[model samples]
Target: MKDTIKEKVASAVRSVYGIDASDAIEKASFEPPRKKEFGDVATNAAFILAKVLRRPPLEIARQIAEQLSGEKEFTRIEVAGKGFVNFFLSPRFYEELLKKIVETDFYVSDIGKKKKVLIEYVSANPTGPLHVGHGRGAVVGDVLSRVMALTGYKVDKEFYINDAGRQIKLLGLSIYYRIQELAGRNLTLPDDAYMGEYIVEIAKELMLKYPEIVDMEEEKAIELAAEFGKKVLLEEIKKTLERLKVEFDNWFSEKSLYNDGKVEKVLEFLKEKGLIYEKDGALWLKTSQFGDDKDRVVKRSTGEYTYFASDIAYHYDKILRGYDKGIDIWGADHHGYIPRVKAAIEALGESGDWLEVILIQLVKLFKHGEEVKMSKRAGNFVTLDWLMDEVGVDAVRFFFLTKRHDTPLDFDIDLALSEKSENPVYYVQYAHARISSILDKAKEEGIEPSTEHLNLLREEEFELILKCYGLKSTLESVAKKREPHLLPYYLIELASAFHKYYNKNRVVDTDSPELSSARLYLVSGVRKTIRSGLNILNVNAPGRM
Candidate 1:
């Protein structure tokens, strides 16, 4: 409906001033007015057309308002301050929209048009459990994927494992030496060894799994320890993510990029393009030529590939996969890494714009207005597991999405657990539950909702309908900006509007059955819209809160 209005305005612009409509197509917007009395939807078409038409802005607005006034879609067309043209939708518009929204196809759009996109996020090293920081990235990536899929994109969720790195080697050694100390052997843990007790737990498991591991040679024991630690930890990570309702279609291993000489193959490709150069004792890529701060090393003098080298190869592999686009969600500390990654992709003969990176900032946890001090498990940070148990899966996901991905977030634990409107997740769920309970009572009273008397709906009912009406546009904005936080913020405002309208108007009235049935249909429409919105965030909208 919004799209049709915008296209009509674009057509009017072309008809009024002989300019091509394409110039104003993207600019023709029909957003809601700030003041309700101003009108329902406001368009700045005259402002956009003033230069092209060579007239005062108000005159141009009046001309376009005259053209649009004859249409039945709007009941009132007013020329607002300066050149703003405000449109109040007609009763028939709301009547038709209310019926369309009851069906399943109202909010879905073909904007994405089936373009394949790969979203990779929460690829934390498998050496430890996922922390609250990882939780933020997980929700952002997962929500963005859902929004994209809603707009007709074929999306793939991926997690790239950094299993072939110095960190994994360090993990193996930590478990190995810890096991030696447990067996009463004389050995000291290296200064740089992992300090988490989880490493000791893995070492014990390895000892029990292989009774002769302690008797084995040092190299074999470390290899066994590495495999055992990564496998166990990876399993726990999967379970934690599942508990949070995150699913990954692909678990890609960094080691796979190194297999079958893939890293060497990328080096050769860069060399052929003359993008690789040697400096001192290392092979470097001319990343500065591609807008990085400086060139980055791909291979050291010891003939070992750097982490950046593995990433370049992995992204090059992504190019071969034939995705229309790719996105990466990384930690706040990785903001500086974006340039080099894009540079690597460009050097591989693809436009750097094909890849998008969203950096998720740090999350600071608070409980009862005090900062959360420690985790229940052995770690310096709060784990995702403890968070899910402390509040819940719904609260954790919703709170993590409360802030923009690039901004620092302060998560209030107490408010999340609250049952009042102070908690956004609860507030939205309560509205849905309230509607469900009303519908249930109506069922008991033998009153079923019918669209038979929709014209009986007044300003407040239409106000709520308009609020529920912006779902399509809000989702499009989210998908384009790659921001999932918009959905949570939007759902809150929508719930508040529904609550205000519900307070003064009785949805189930025994005095007037016809009016009661109409309001019930309106209430049911709001319930379905809220449920669809919450589903995008993987936050359940319960029938009973």
Candidate 2:
């Protein structure tokens, strides 16, 4: 749409002053005016070209306006506020948009050329179940992927499993000792051992799968248990995500990268670039040269590669897969990791811009204004599964995305579970269901209004139609900014506008057929918009809630 406006303005400038398109068009900027009275759209072309044309900005704007006099889409074009070209679009423009909305299957406009994008999110360690903090990242990444896909981007949602790290080793040892304790054997669990009942359950599963390993030495038993525990835990994680309405295209494993020699290849590439050097008996990457805080170790003195090294290999694999861009959704606690990862990408001679990181802040759970404590020992952390079972998947997802990704989220359980209409998710869904009910009534009454009769829509109908037209721009801005919170806010505002219109007017009044038909068209458009918004958030838009 911006491109369309730019071309039209450029053509008008070229036709008015006989200036070259390149020079005249290069100076133009299309911006939405701040005030509706100014216009729906505005440009600063006259201000930019005033000096080159040796004329006042208003005079240049006047000449361009004269050249664009017969443009039907724009109702009026005028120079305002020291050379701004303000254009008020004709009501027919909005009518056409409404017709398209009713005729189309989706609400969002097609703005992208369907570029493939891989979004890896909530790649938490599988040693334990996901906490509420991980849930925030999960919902943000999921909703963003949905929004991008809705806007015509081919999105590949992914989860990176860190099953090959020291955490997994600790998990194995924890289960081995817990099994010993359960068997009346004296053994002390290590400090780093996982302290959850799930460990005991995993140990039981391991004993059933491989009874021969139960009698082996502790070290060997731990090694076997770690491998088995990782698989079981990962399965549970997948189940939890599925319950939350989240799924991934791929589950990339860190251990697979090691088995395939991808880590070695990434290190060799850095070595070839002179970015890796051995210092103090440890292999270090010169990340400081690439704007990192300090040089980081790729391999520690203990001969074990650091997690950062594995990350570099993982990202290298992503680039090798031929994706134009890669995105990682992580918790805010890992904010310090961004610069080093970007430095690694740069050191590898790839553009750092291709790697994007979205940091989701912590989620603080509250019940009646008091903090809800999480106990790892009792397995009482607010897991995503528990949240879904309590308030349902739709409410959980909608609440998670109600705030900016970077802002701290407070999940009030009492408020979310309330039966009142104050809950925003319920409110939005209710509005949609109400509109659906009205449409159903219309359909049953044999009063099907065709698109031709939609031309009789009134002022409130046009206002709602204009709001629908802004969805394209709103979605574009939200996706480009990696912000999904805007969608929920827009949904609430749109619902409020609809409810206000609903309270003031009667949709099925038998006296005036024109008004009734117009109201029906407006209601149909609102229903589509509501469903589209809910779909992007992974929430349900029910016919009856």
Candidate 3:
């Protein structure tokens, strides 16, 4: 419906001023008026076009309003303050919209135009299990992936494993020391080594599998322990992600960048372009030339490649694979890392904007008005798996998205477990279940949902119908803004509208059978929309609560 209005205004500009306003058309937005009395939808197209057409906004708005006032879908079109054109849609528009909703899935859109997008997220190191912070990024990426795919983007979900580097070495050393201690050998565990109990468990398992590993040479034993520990922890991460309904198409190993010589390949290219130089016996990239605050070291003086080297190679590989865009989900602490990565991409001859980074802020759990800290299983921080077990997959996924990805989220456990409207996930799901019960009861009463008398729907019912139709815009906004949190809020508002309508209206009046069928049909659209939304979030929409 918004698109229809946009196209009409674009046509009006072409017909009125004989100017190609495609750019202005793209910039214009048709949104609901802030006040209910203003109109159903309002557009700032005239204001956007004024700069192009060189006319006063109010004059342009009046012209556009006059051009649109005769459209059959709208009862009136008014020129409001500062060139805003407000459109009052007619009852017939609501009738047709409700009919479209009942007859088909009207919310699906093709805004993405088949763009190839790679969303890499939850790329936590294999040295430990995924913590709550990683869980937050995982949900953001997964939900964004789902929404993009629904809107017609060819999306591939990926996890970039930091399997090569000091972290993995520390994981191995941590396990190796635990093995020695278990074998009654005197040793001091390094402070930097992993302190999680899972490390000790991995060591015990490694010892059972390779009994002589305890007596093996230190370097060799630690190497084996590191590999074994990485495998075990990575398997645990995959299982936890699956339990939370998150899956990835690719698990790209950081080690592969080295094994396949991609890091050297990128360095050679940069060197040939004179973008690489040596300083203090360490190789540096002229990142500052491309907008970085200073040069970045790709190789340390001791000769080990830095993590930035592999990161550059990884992103260069992403571009080589023909992805139109790459999205990386990282912790907010990595904010400073964004410029250098984008600078590397720019130096490599791709637009820096080709890669987008979403920084996920911290997630702190609250129970009984107090902050809940630490997971006994994870040793230092809360684990995603533990949180899921404490509540459920649905609650965890929904609550993670209750806030913007870049903002801090304080998850309230009591509210999530509650069976009240304050619990957003419950409220949305209950709306679905409630609608199902209504339709079933209507069926038992020998009435079937029909769009035959949708015009019988009252003003409140039309408002509910309009809210149901908002799923289209909600998804478009999410895909455009890369904000999945809007989806939960949209569903909540839609559900609220339905619940209010239910409290104030009757749907199964036997004497008014036509009205009953029409109301049931509207109710069915709401159920479909809520279920569709929950499915995108990978949450369950139960028929019974």
lDDT (C-alpha, whole model) for all candidates: 0.88, 0.82, 0.92
Model 1 quality (TM-score): 0.93
Better of 1 and 3 by lDDT: 3
Q: Which pairs of residues clash in candidate 1, taking residues 3 or more apart in a chain or in different chains?
A: none
- For every candidate in turn, the CA RMSD to the true structure comes to 2.6, 2.9, 2.1
- lDDT string, candidate 2, 155-272, tens digits: 8999999989789888888888877876778987777677767888887777777776667898999898888888888988888888888889999999998999989889999999
Instruction: Give the better candidate number (1 or 3) by TM-score.
Output: 3
Give the worst 10-residue stretch by lDDT in candidate 3: 99-108
lDDT of 3 at 57: 91
Q: Lowest-scoring 10 consecutive residues by lDDT in candidate 2? A: 104-113
What clash pairs does model 2 have? none
Q: Which candidate do you rate higher for lDDT, 2 or 3?
A: 3
Predicted structure with the largest lDDT when compared to the true one: 3
Q: Any runs in candidate 1 off by more than 4 Å, and if so which?
A: 10-23, 35-38, 46-68, 78-84
The number of the candidate with the highest TM-score is 3
Model 3: residues >4 Å from true position, as ranges? 10-23, 35-37, 47-70, 79-84
